[model samples]
Target: MVIPTTSISTDSLTSLASPSPTLDFYDSPEPAFSFLVQRIDSLLDCSSAQKTHHQRRLPSLTSFVRQVYVKCRLSPAILVIALIYIQRLQHELPIDSKGDYDTPHKVFLAAIILACKFNDDSKSRVQSIYQCVSVVYTNIDVNEMERSFLGVVNYDLYVDIKQLCQFIQEHPTLELNWED
Candidate 1:
């Protein structure tokens, strides 16, 4: 299937590129983009490995994230925000134990939820958001994941416009290219 590109408006881009506070996502988008790309590669690598019985239910985390992006009808900017939150949560709360499969998926869901809440003007209800994620996870699982995500990220969801504009500039063809 061809994955669709998410578009960002010019007004949003201009505002995002301007200087903003430290909490903004675009304040340091370059590093975050680098980190996001590497982390996604690593996760894809992990998901590609042979699965044991314990990991049977887990879908491909990378593909699943893309699916969430498409199913939620999220803008590319929101996708970037979600990715940033995922990175932040991962950094703050590393998975030291063996059962790591579920954690990443949970974090992804939580990041999507947070991103939608912050970026989308017409908000998606929590239940509906959970419903979109429920295909791969239970409601209870999603709730736990959301709570864990909030705790780890300290509920900071502000993304800078500059970093966002930088990301769009760096990935000019992200929306137009269908190579993924």
Candidate 2:
């Protein structure tokens, strides 16, 4: 699969691999389009992703993502990295009942949280992010979700520049908007 857009090239993503606050791509300004949400919706639909049972109805993926996008100050790069992490976790799983571990919200939340921490150098940034997410998931729930995510990937958090480009190339339809 190839990305149809010329704007978001491998070179752009390579630069964003070590994003800084000064870069326009590092901080998410409110999106005018819901591109990431649409891509992720299709991803979960196509992959071996699962959801948990709860008394109350879970929030829609779009809403969940939007809230996280703004509240967590997430960029397209961070969300793309989260997608990479989620796909890696899915690939590592058994594709059976044992793999059906958590709800998509929890999984998504965990991925975003992990991405936030991994992308940023500040402990305060991640801690503040955790506080924002803990309102939806208890601190314990978030911790377990994080641990499960890490364990599935065998504590391998690194996504090299080549590998990241490869992942984007493989899932070209999920083209991230690199421009503001």
Candidate 3:
């Protein structure tokens, strides 16, 4: 499938050049695009040779993320926000050392879902796409994951401009794009 060219329009809930006063998911020259993908893929920690038994059943993390990004037409800001959610959730949730729960994939999924819901204007369309994609997850499973994530994070979904700028500056690659 052809991925539409990304653009930026902060006039809505989103931007193309820099982090606006609020969060937005518009197409812009995403110099940070590849960096964002790499960052999320690294978080999965499941390379082809290192795939856990469960991971083997799913698409490569990079593949899964790209599919979601392209199909959903997600903006770079949404991508950044998803990473933030993942980081926050990692601290709030009690990850199971035994490897039963808190799988990176699940956390990634929930973060993306939350980000999409929070950032997208045509939420119903976005929601419909999520229900269909995201690999083997059913709608109910998606709902539970989202609910669990919100509970753990105390429903803190806000991504302000300063916070976004801070996160970008912290991630050198992203900062480069924002500065350019």
Query: Once model 3 is optimally superposed onto the true structure by TM-score, how far is the C-alpha of residue 63 displaced, in angstroms?
Result: 1.2
Task: Give the per-residue Cα lDDT of candidate 1 at 88.
Answer: 70
lDDT of 3 by residue, 1-180 (tens): 323335433334452334344333333324355555555444433324534543556665555666677666666666787878876765675544223222445666778878777765566646755665545666776788789789988998887666767886787655334422
Per-model TM-score on C-alpha atoms: 0.61, 0.65, 0.68
* Candidate No. with top TM-score: 3
Give me the candidate number with maximum lDDT.
Answer: 3
Ranking by TM-score: 3, 2, 1
Question: Residue 91 of candidate 2: its Cα lDDT?
Answer: 74
Off by over 4 Å in 3: 1-5, 14-57, 95-102, 131-135
lDDT (C-alpha, whole model) for all candidates: 0.55, 0.57, 0.60
> Which pairs clash in model 1?
16-161, 16-162, 17-161, 17-162, 24-160, 25-159, 25-160, 26-160, 26-163
**What TM-score would candidate 3 get against the native?**
0.68
lDDT, model 2: 0.57
Identify the superior model by TM-score, candidate 1 or candidate 2. 2
The true-versus-predicted C-alpha distance at residue 49 of model 2, in Å, is: 16
Clashes of each: 9, 0, 8
